[model samples]
Target: MGAEAILEKIRQNAEEEAAALRRQGEERAAAAAEKIRAEAAADAEALLESARRSAEELSRREDLMTGLEARKNALAARRAVVDEAFSEAHRMLLALPAERWEALISRLVLEASETGEEVLEVPASDREKYENGLLERLNAALERSGRKGKLTLAGAPGKMEGGFRLVGPVYDVDCSFEMLLSLVREENEREIARLLYPETRAAGE
Candidate 1:
């Protein structure tokens, strides 16, 4: 063959080889890029799932905290109501009218006079009520009830709220309004709660 024709053939073969090499490199690069894209998509999906789980956990914790706070507030409110009810009752008893108060004192004195000879220690505020007529009335009631009517009032008044104390030789009996209510409260706190919260009682039952 001629030299020019041989050289032309050699150049054409070299060009075809270069084009095949370029095509192979491009295919390999495209495959690598596809792999990288798939990996990135999987990583993004995993991150999204983790974030969703975290958000759900945080939401649940918040809801639990809110419920506990609400329950605490409700319990506090209920306690306040019960306390107010007892306070109102105490105020009413302390403000009893004169005639009713005298009768109550007489009744209490009669009940407390175990020996009927105990010294009656009354509050200074109520000393005049007993001195005027209550002491005589209490003695008569005690005598009628088959006890010695030898009760005497103490010279110095006692520290009391709204009742008297019987100071005997060996023991003493406290019949103050505060004492009476405290005793009643100790025995009947649940009943009072039930009356104020019938729904709670019904649920418990």
Candidate 2:
């Protein structure tokens, strides 16, 4: 062969080899770019999932807090209603006529006189009633009930709304309206609640 022909053949072979190497390098670079893209997509999906879970958790917590706050407000409203009912009862009792109050006081005195020798401590406002022969009436009622006790009015008036305190030599008896209501409040509260909030009671049941 001629020298020019041999040189041309060698150049052609080198160009073919270079072209193959370039093709291989392009293929490797394309595979690497695809791998990087797949990894990036996976990382993005994971971040999105984490954010979704965090958002759901936060929403659940907010719902729970809202429910708790609503319950607290409902309980406070119920308490206010119960307190108002008791206050109304007190007002009604205090609004009774003088004759009715006297009769009530007479009955209370008769019921309270234990040994018939206790001192009746009434409110300062009620001193006049005792002075007006109410004590005599109370004694007669006590005698009828077979209690051999005499009731005398105390010199020091009690600080009370209504009803009297029977002061005995041994122990004193509190028969004031406030004290009586306090003694029965726990039992009365259930009845009052049932009446005031029948829906709540039915829902609970």
Candidate 3:
């Protein structure tokens, strides 16, 4: 396929991946949240019942302690759901087929290229992939877009497990899958937490 067509495929794949992530996160959260809610409610009831049998001061302390612990455990469980979603995303990205993988990294490289002449630093495992024709296609895309179009693939393998980096004279850009996914998680963490425990969020608000 042509450079533009590859880029378009990359965009479509990105949209699909994002949608899949949202669905996986929502499904996991929905599944785990209900179980946690019921368990927490039951535990709270049992704690309250036991507290009632204690002296007034002791009952108050017990209630406070148990409530704090319950909140801590609930928060932990919710965080786990968010963690699993990203883990699945990482898995899916790594598991992509060769064509899709080429499309993705190509798109990322094109976007990250500031001058279109930066050296492409790919994972050591993928050197042959880029050397084969990836760099030429990227340069073609860059030139077509009115950039320098002098991009070259690095001989040494990069440190990133997945994704590539653009090494420019002034600065470098990291487009590693790890950093990208972390950025996604950082931006949507609160929103994901709320989704997992909407009732708690609503009560707080």
The candidate that achieves the highest TM-score relative to the unseen native structure: 3
**Tens-place lDDT digits, model 1, residues 1-205:** 1222222222223222212222223464355335533433333333223223433444444445556676555445545544554455556666768886676666666655666788988889888877887788889888999989889999999897767677877556666666544543443445545533444766998
Candidate 3: worst-modelled 10 consecutive residues by lDDT = 1-10
Q: What TM-scores do the predictions have?
A: 0.58, 0.57, 0.61
Please report how far candidate 1 places residue 8 from its true position, in Å. 99
Pairs of colliding residues, candidate 1 = none
| Clash totals, every prediction | 0, 4, 0
lDDT of 2 by residue, 86-153 (tens): 45545555665888667666655654455777798998887887788888888877778787647888
List the RMSD of every prediction in angstroms. 44.4, 43.7, 15.2
Instruction: Please identify model 2 stretches exceeding 4 Å from their true place.
Output: 1-67, 189-204
TM-score-based ranking, best first?
Answer: 3, 1, 2
Which pairs of residues have clashing backbones in candidate 2?
A: 115-149, 116-149, 116-150, 117-150
Sequence-dependent TM-score of model 3: 0.61
Report lDDT (Cα) of residue 173, candidate 2. 58
lDDT of 3 by residue, 1-205 (tens): 1222222323444433322222223464355334433333333322222122222333234345557777565555545544555566676676678998887877777666667878888898888877788878889998998899999888788898888777877656666777556544443445554545555566998
Ranking by lDDT: 3, 1, 2
- Reference-based lDDT, residue 23, model 2: 19
lDDT computed for candidate 2: 0.54
